[model samples]
Target: MANIIITGTSRGIGFELVKLFAKEGHQVLALSRNVQPVQRLDLSNVHCFSFDLGNPNDFKKVEAFLEQWNVVDVLINNAGSLLNKPFAETTIEEFERVYKVNVFGVAEMIRTVRHKMGKEGHVVTVSSMGGVQGSMKFPGLSAYSSSKGAVITLTELLAEEYKETGPSFNVLALGAVQTEMLEEAFPGYQALVTALEMATYIKDFALTGHKLYNGKLLQVSNSTP
Candidate 1:
């Protein structure tokens, strides 16, 4: 089984992903600010701890874990910070907070893990349809959507920069899924996709998608939210 590292595993798609990988007999390092939810699962193969992307100190914890695990087969940047407010109302501090996690934090995570990743490694960054240029843009997401867009470009650039060394990089521009983040950002909005369904797809892609694709941005969505 592959060694997998997943972020934001407290709930939603991230939480489901931890369960899937662990059940498959893979070694999983689940990262989330609220680790209790995953800790309760008690899976021997799954190790989890409190991880906050915005906290610079949290990266040290990952570095320590890598010392024991050594190599990383897959690293999924699933943690995101969402800010929903009118463009005019959004403050710089608030905007920077979202970017701190969605953009900068992702870059740091990749940097920390790339040394341990070989040619077979895969890094999957979860984005949103809203980040895709020409996708339907919604209001009250200036900071959130823009940060996601930055990540898409970052993934592409890194893929080319590290093309020869391996550990292919990709981004998934997902449509609206019934996640807590979605519910909080857009109240009363119903999504046709479920978190578990998306998590399953992400799992499959993370494991083998690198064979067929590298530096690819897949827009996985039937409907825009």
Candidate 2:
């Protein structure tokens, strides 16, 4: 049983991830902007916390909670924001908001927990396939994609910097998964992959992928890569 920290667990992929991990007997620290949904689940192994990732100040609460656990086996940076708008029409505020949650938020979370990670610790940050240079790009996702691109770079740098520190870092560039976030970004579009399916894969990867993969950017999709 590992101690896992997963963010954005109120719903969607994060929610499913919490369920999967908790059901498997892992101790899960599930963080979300709102904790009501997680609390309603009443899972014995899942502990819920509420905080806004866009605000770094909110992480102090997370730190306090971590003080009690003392050790973390996996940290899944799954919280994210999306803004689908043409670059010409996108405001600076919108761009900043995306970066706040997608880039800076992930950085702060990692900083808060890095020292508490055990020898088998692994850090997984979820990016988007749209963030990849050669992947299919949509015109209106400049801000979102740019922020995700930054996450991939950040993960790579962290892995290299912490190569001998025991905790392995990796990034997962994911394809469109059926979730509220995807539906909001692309109305009426159907995703080939479901959030539950992605969550299952993530659970397995978080449990053992670090043993063989580090500093790697993996692409996950049901479509042809």
Candidate 3:
């Protein structure tokens, strides 16, 4: 079993990922703003840490916990923020909030745990199809989509920086999935995929797919544009 760290584990896709990884007997460190839900899961293989990804100061707690671990096999940056509003009405604060959680937070987490990663370590950050140019662009998602685009760029840069170091970096530009975030962003609309299904694919990818590609941005979807 490998040691894995997942962010935003309290609910949605992150919550499902915790269940799948714990069921597989991997040592999972789950981080979220409120970890009570994960604690209630009652999985011995999973440990919950309460921290807000939008706040960089809170990352110290994650760093402290990872300091005790000798090796971390995978780091899944799943925590994110979404702001669905017309560009005309979007405020600077909203844009910063989205970037703080989706971009800066992910970068800080990787920097904190990178030293704990072993030779085969993998870092997988969740992106979105909305971030892909010429894919499917949606209005009222400029801030959120832009933040995800930054994540994909950052992943590529890290992969190149660490090419000789052994750890692999990749991003998954996911399509619409049935999660609370999706419902909030696009109310009354049903998605083609479920959180559990997405989590399963992500778990498999982190464990096995990393070996196949590095510095790659994968588009996970069932339909074509």
lDDT of each: 0.95, 0.91, 0.91
Highest lDDT, which number? 1
Across 59-163, the per-residue lDDT of candidate 1 in tens digits comes to: 999999899977899999999999989999999999999999999999999999999999999999999999999999999999999999999999999999999
What candidate 2 gets wrong by more than 4 Å, as runs, is none
The list of candidate 1 runs beyond 4 A from truth reads none
**Candidate 1 clashing pairs?**
none
For 1-225, candidate 2 gives per-residue lDDT tens digits of 899999999989999999999888999999999999999999988998788999878999988888878789999999999898889999999999999999999999999999998667999999999888788888889999989999999998989998988699989999989999998888888898899999999999998999999989999976622
The lDDT, on a scale of 0 to 1, for candidate 1 is 0.95
The estimated TM-scores of all candidates read 0.99, 0.97, 0.97
Assess candidate 3 and give its TM-score to the true structure. Answer: 0.97
- Residue-wise lDDT of candidate 3 within 43-84, one digit each (tens)? 998988789988878888887887768899999999989899
